[model samples]
Target: MLETVRRQRRAAALPYPQMTLAVPVAIEGAALHSGKTVRMTLRPADADHGIVFRRIDLEGGRDVTDIRVRHDRVVETTMSTVVGNAAGARVGTIEHLMAALSGLRVDNVLIEIDGDEVPVLDGSAEVFVDRIEATGLTALDAPRRAIRILKPVVVEDGAKRAALLPGDGFSLAFEIDFDNPVIGRQAIEADLYDPCFADDILRARTFGFLKDQEALRAAGLGQGASLENAIVIDGENILNEDGLRYEDEFVRHKLLDAVGDLSLSGLPLLGRYEGVRSGHAMNNRVLCALMADETAWEVVDFVEASRPAYAAEREMLAISAD
Candidate 1:
């Protein structure tokens, strides 16, 4: 049974046809930093359109922002991923939605938003995933492309670090340590293409220390934050009445953020990503570094299991055949 499942997962992880939503989906919620209610519509796009954001409320939708999902467009990463264009138009707190798109392998989308930031619906990707799934996905005629790591790339800031190495399929390992006893240290590793993503990673709410709430608010951030949208840790206790979604929810959420950050590369990645106490900034830095050295990565249309270009392919095949 285990071997059969591994084979099925490997087959599913193979390069697939480009896909887009079958129909438009709409969502409305409060923006995390601004605390303002906003409406967003996820619309399907043709092949190679990638993911785009249009500020419909500005100039009657003339202000459209193409989300390159790259480091150059990332204007801010202090609290959440913010992408901006040269015209000064920006969309903040996009990671959760991006993660949902990546997890479902939605290749091209046009996100129409009436606000500067995405709504922090439940402070997790769950709501976004639910709506997108409800709309369903349709595969395009074009083949999908993946960014295959040819060599290792690493970035570090103090004790925080993020890296990517050649691998067959997308996988991530993340570790986070917080002084608060409620979190402490936790780590997790999983293949991004696995079914576990929707069940495990998508629902883990973003968390913060109760002590930092006031400071964050003073900094004009987390204005929409409440016990309803996020997990709040006060000392050794959890302030949320329902408690955590997972035993190591903190680290799982970190991995969720990483998935969203890495998806900014515009192409699905075929590599192993490892992060240690890393956040949005570090994740973007590693991606930038990888892209800077063109020799470190290549764009491929398909994964050839026989050639075994990546180390993880051999391991995956071995597990599948066992």
Candidate 2:
């Protein structure tokens, strides 16, 4: 059983050619922050195009900006991740869609949005994941590139922290703590490359405290936030009609955000990420720190034969966990 598990993991860890969607997929919903109806289309792009977002609503639809997903393009991380280009065109709240693309291992895509923010879509990546899967994936001739950590990189802001360490496959471990008894502390760890991501992480919805709703709205944020799109906590009780998706869903959502934020590196990462009370800002900071230190990480092409060694490393980590 152990060997079978190892083999499955090894297969998943092995990298292959780059991939894009087989066909274009479109989704329409209300932008979380703007609360305006928006239409987005995920279009297939050639290899090496990377993931770029184009704002089609600007300048009578004549303005097309390729906002690369990178730390430098990040203009805001207050309540959500926002990326912009030199032209000042920006896209906000892209974490969930980015997370879906990362989870599906898509290498190149053109995200065309008709508004400033991507739709919240149930406050989770579930809908995005389903749509992408329905479109299917198409393999390109070019090899996939991955950012492999060579040394530990850490970033912190007060008590919040996020880090990326040398590891074999993409894995994530997160810890979160809130003063409310409803969510005092929670932690979760998983190999993101595994199939578990779709089931375990994609459905985890973003959450917030009910007490802060008014303050958030006053700040011109969370204008569309409600029980329909987010997990709202009020003191010791969950205000959602369906309650929790998972007991520790708050932390899992954190993991999902980390995946999306880190994907800004423009390549899939081969590292283990650890976060404690970290949010979008900390996640982006950690990525910036890793990129700033050239010696800390290296981009490499995934080779199939090398996967077993990586699998062995994961085995050791599992043993230590036991």
Candidate 3:
């Protein structure tokens, strides 16, 4: 990603630095999909290990799954993204945690989950970001790597559309429309170069129309979602007892979700992304298209940096290329 190119380390000026933590951080809460309580510990991983999920609740059950988004494992895209291996073991609605990791610029992690889904804590990545930020960031001996899409790939479902285009840095443009007066049409475009961008949009909660509640519950879904964690809307009104975080929070929240979903790439993506009335399905389609095109991507290592401490941190990264 372009962010690494500007990294202030001549000795550590490498593109991707294997990153780790000075200490481990623990987070406890409820998962959005499985609707169960969870307490997870986040430990530093070595370079190339990327991100992984470990299920400790299963005495001998095979619940662990890698967070890396791949073409073969995306199982659902209706309300959330569900990823798993051939065995059908998976994690659901991983956007919030993904947003938190990407927001804090964390490239590698080992997530130990006690339940089927990540806690829907506050319906935002802020909590996760705060907890992880407290642990701080350390550099690795290597530089950071990026996913640079070499060609334009687009996916569409009727009026909905999502696409990835070549770009120098990571960027996103999202637009949503709801005929309801409370959240009519809203849009946002961001170049994720500033660290504060995530802080600005990452905490907005997910929202839904009141009319859809019954159908959701009938299908045994959204049992855990409520005003406390999401912005509920009824007809033309916003249903949360509390007010909106921002007048245009609907769009901001969408961007937040996109940030987390895009993180499936394992490496930070280096390109421009656009979504028009897009959701989990469309987003996954874009990634699938990229993977389907072999010429669209390549793997490369970092070559520069001026920071010795970061260089030392890079050495600490514990991932393998394969």
Candidate 4:
């Protein structure tokens, strides 16, 4: 019996195989912060390769630099997520693409770019999700792994906070309160395990306040921000002619950001995440806190899943060395 099982494992017949893109996809647009035109391509990768960003524009593509998408590689969280290597090769605003990959369960991909930031197409993950879906996905010959929260891990900054708690499957709840009357207070909750719900999250666009435009420009940010890419609020009303995508779009966008930020873990997460007015910094901080305490989390394989009382499928989380 042991020999039979060993043979099966060696044959790469795993219960849950990792996934990668079936074909290469490309896109070109203006980066949100830099306001510079850039092009990016997503290519298929081998199993266990993880998601990596390759800077092909560096030194005029003479020597390409690869940066793995992982939490420890995160170097900045100022209005956007930025990952860098020791040599200061950095890529910013990766949260949207990251979220799309996480939702699609794409385990391995090679993202080649000719820019410092991923193009903020409509300030949402919809473009990325659509392109990837059209290209399709293929299963690899390796088992999938996820970080299972064994205990509650929390981080807070004054009134803002984020937490990851033990759960059978992935889910998120977020609440945000803006001073502007147009936004005011809003909250959203979703079972990310559901593909349809995740798709909705991907469509939620990032928002900004028109009042802060000058200040943001002075600080060298939001250089490419415009009504076409983001929902701009002007205190009492939304500046966009088309108006809101969802009634609670403000909060939904926050939840969308959390999905992308938490994906820095470099694997799918099996747990519940709750955030209260949290931003990029707090999201990264919460992840750091979860990883700091060794007893809080464990790597587990997807053996199977069961239909729970909730609408989403509850994964049966476990791992075995054999």
* Candidate with best lDDT: 2
Task: Point out where model 1 deviates above 4 Å.
Answer: 1-15, 60-67, 304-322
Q: Per-residue CA lDDT of candidate 3, range 1-322, in tens?
A: 3233334433243344667654688988876655678888888888677777776765554433444444356788778877776555677878878877876667778888777677888888878877876667667666678777789999989889889887655778999987789988999877665545766788788888778888887887788888877888987778787879989888888888888888887777777889998888888888888878989876555333213543554454422211
What's the lDDT for all of these models? 0.85, 0.86, 0.74, 0.84
Question: Each prediction's TM-score against the native?
Answer: 0.89, 0.90, 0.86, 0.90
Candidate 2 on 1-322: residue-level lDDT in tens?
Answer: 2234334434455447788998999999988887899999999999999999988878633244668878879999998999998878899999999999988888899998889999998999999998888768887888888889999998888889999998877889999988889888999997767756789998999999989999888988889998989999998999999999998889999999999999999999988899999999999999999999999999898532234645566577556645
Model 1 residue 142 CA deviation in Å? 0.1
Clash number for model 2?
A: 0
Q: What is the lDDT of residue 147 in candidate 3?
A: 74
Worst 10 residues of 2 by lDDT: 1-10
Ranked by lDDT, the better of candidates 2 and 3 is: 2
Rank all candidate structures by their lDDT, best first, as comma-separated numbers. Answer: 2, 1, 4, 3
Task: Give candidate 3 regions above 4 Å deviation.
Answer: 1-7, 10-16, 61-71, 301-322
Off by over 4 Å in 4: 1-14, 60-64, 303-322
Query: RMSD in Å for candidate 4, one decimal?
Result: 6.2
**What's the lDDT for candidate 1?**
0.85
